[model samples]
Target: MQPISRRTVLAGASALVAGPALARADRWARVVAAARRYDQLHAILVAHRGRTVVAEAFRGDGLDAPANVKSVSKSIVALLLGAAIDRGVVPSVEARLAEVAPRLIPTDAEPQVYELTLQDLVTLRAGLERTSGSNYGAWIASDNWVADALSRPFVAEPGGRMLYSTGSFHVLGAALAEASGRDLLTLTRDWLGDPLGIQVPPWTRDPQGYYMGGNQMALSPRAMLRIGNLMRRGGRWQDARILPRAWVEACLTPVTTSPYSGLGYGYGWFVTQTSAGRLGLARGYGGQIIAVAPDAEAVVAITSDPTQPARSGGYFGDLLSLIAEEVLAAT
Candidate 1:
């Protein structure tokens, strides 16, 4: 046998390293190409095993520029709840709204509302009439957003079926504010923003100046991926424990079901099965999503046009397909 030359040995080793990288790039290219077919999609980003596999902007803002995440704000609020629990600011998920923010609970609220826990709010199981969809305008028009939400008639029982109500999350945010003695913006900036190194611009606020929690928050696509990664890694970020692993697990545990999409609803996340593994999805209006596949070691974020709607039967379904079939497949 011929002795291999030093230069030839190095060349062979380089090819060995480059081959898998080239294949990964090609796969990600296909994923990006697939994403471009959606007119509403503004950006798609994917990170696998701590490395960014793809990041592309098709329209609207750049990947790093903040865009309206719509109801993904709900998911962020849920995360803040976890952080608050980790810091002992609000006790635990079992803490009752009446216990934490009695001032925001309207006197006319059903007696059962006082017994509702933080879990009920985060899981959309507060059993209150929904303020989302057609009721959104009237709810926001009220003088007191928290009181208005709390005053809604009982639609179910607390800890019952998912109501898909943004009002539930809004109440949760208000409770957090009352408990922490800090506004939503400050909590977000201090807990998630500084740790993840992302910007969270202030979004809408209620008449009483509490930041709206379930809608209108803004985050860049890159920032969304970081949030996904935080969950995917079980609440740790870059050597720091941003959230307790137990809290992350509990957050992803399915507690209810979304009536609109038929997906299992956890604490501020939608749970679904993917080819790769169980996915924890944070979705917003107009197709915005942050999908985390912990078993697959991948996280994907997509942002879409804020003005348009992406219903489950339409554009949102298409986005889910793209993530499960193309994006996760590549990862």
Candidate 2:
């Protein structure tokens, strides 16, 4: 091999810096230091303009180790749903859920159940009794997760309100698989993983062999950042259109205002207005997050232990917001 030229070395170094001059130094350092101090976070990945600016693994997890991304998996499922639609596997979001999975619906199902649509599930307005709040532990322990999720009684009129439910996304996953004649993991690998060069490991499946859709999906921090970056680029990876532009816009658009946090939630992402601008995020239980800010052309992924309450919203969200405010602000 020929000796490397000074110009080639400088070009390589320049590519490593994510964005403009400000992002190359103090801004990147501040984010790394803050995450270490506050959240005891396992890994942090920051990308700017489609390049890795800060990619560091910590807390005993290697860069390739898959981290359980909890509810952030919902966002991944959302991508699959969009891809399914684009491929003509599913007709449209307006399609009724009962029509898609008639076998799953009880013969004497509640009237509200009939009213639930694919759109309602994606937006978390399906009106099903939620599995996220008080019923979380029980839902996890149940052997027949899909049956248990579909068995929930209607608590409100479909499309009348928003209720956070992992079960809703689970149902969507099931419907997609049923319609496509492929398993959730297989569909995801074909639609997303293969195209993006991200490996989503063999996901945990229910007894029925359906991959769990809304939670506990495993991906490396780098993989998580790639997903965020895809969204940041309007669902296109490099030159290929992995998801439709319309679907991406719809997924990121706010559907309901959150009752607990005042943030806006869309299909599977949370929309928050911070000092840096509008930030779209996939927030998982226990402080795992993949935040994408289009205005800044930035994506940040973080993973932390969920059992630690202080680390959850207190440090994780704050640290990311601070990075946007203090670091990205200068840029």
Candidate 3:
């Protein structure tokens, strides 16, 4: 009696057409080999020039089931911020935290918190004491998510380093709601879900009822593709422009370097260096990834063991091989 994910509502067309594109040159054979071997992998979806290339599910989860995308939601949040900016719900990224939501700020917070802008939170460089890696559990269990985030001690200057904290994004999500006078759910549904023809189901919420900002969002594999296509197509879905083009460009332009993948970190995406071109991807914990190869005009979405690790040199490296050696080589 759980709420149905309703993923089957969207997989028919992709399943039908995916066979042909994957069959050519045994390109899909490599993908099949990898899928069958990795018990952790659940789905691999690749699309080229607006058509489904490979849409195959391995074992753990069905292709038409919703999977926990974890931190990939961070990228989606970035997109929502962009749309909000377009509509003037919030000013540009340069706008300070005090300007956006002074009411949400803690009266006893360190002075540095007031200096932060929307840009810092999106880039994961808020310089707050870390709340993501070892601190994630305690941060979420706090009575007030926004207050706890704002009250964290500063580890560096406002824009100095990438602290990679979920608290930063969580606080920013509350700030966004305060600035727009609209909840995050409404903004997401109206700006993205409706235009892309995808469903945005409710997921985990902090104790105060704000949606978990940077992690724990769920989506069907096909829905992930729709999001990648939205970015690949420069924030447009068909004739309707979902996110502003300028925002798309700005998100891809690397502002800081990542210590995790040793890649360029844009707004929320982890930008990688590839022989083909700059590979901009929405990477989550485990092997959950949405890779967009703009040079190849291709988009690939992957969902794997969300509970397992997918570091750059291990399982994640193999996944990237499928994209670089198999998917891109075929092209």
lDDT for every model?
A: 0.91, 0.80, 0.83
Residue-level lDDT of model 2, residues 4-52, one tens digit each, is: 9999999988877655565456678876776677545778888888888
List model 1 lDDT by residue over 63-182, tens digit each. 989999999999999999999988989878999988888899887878898799999999898888999999999999999999999888997988888898888888899899999999
**Error in Å for residue 49 of model 2:** 0.9
1-331: candidate 3 lDDT, tens digit per residue: 8765557645756766776655663776675676667777889888888788788887657766788998888888888889878999888888899998998888998888888899999998888888888888898888988888888888878777777787887887777778888877777788888889888888888887788888888888998998899888889888888888889877777888887767888888878767877778888899898888878788888999888999889998888887887777665
Clash pairs, model 1 backbone: none
Give residue 241's error in model 2 in angstroms.
1.0
Model 2 Cα displacement at 100 (Å)?
1.6
- Considering every candidate listed, which one attains the maximal TM-score? 1
lDDT of 3 at 15: 68
User: How well does model 2 score by local distance difference test?
Assistant: 0.80
Candidate 1: segments with Cα more than 4 A from true spot: 1-13
| Residue ranges of candidate 2 with Cα displaced over 4 Å | 1-23, 310-313
Per-candidate total of colliding backbone pairs: 0, 1, 0
TM-score of every model versus the real structure: 0.96, 0.89, 0.90
Best candidate per lDDT, number?
1
Root-mean-square deviation of Cα positions for candidate 1 versus the true structure, in angstroms: 1.6
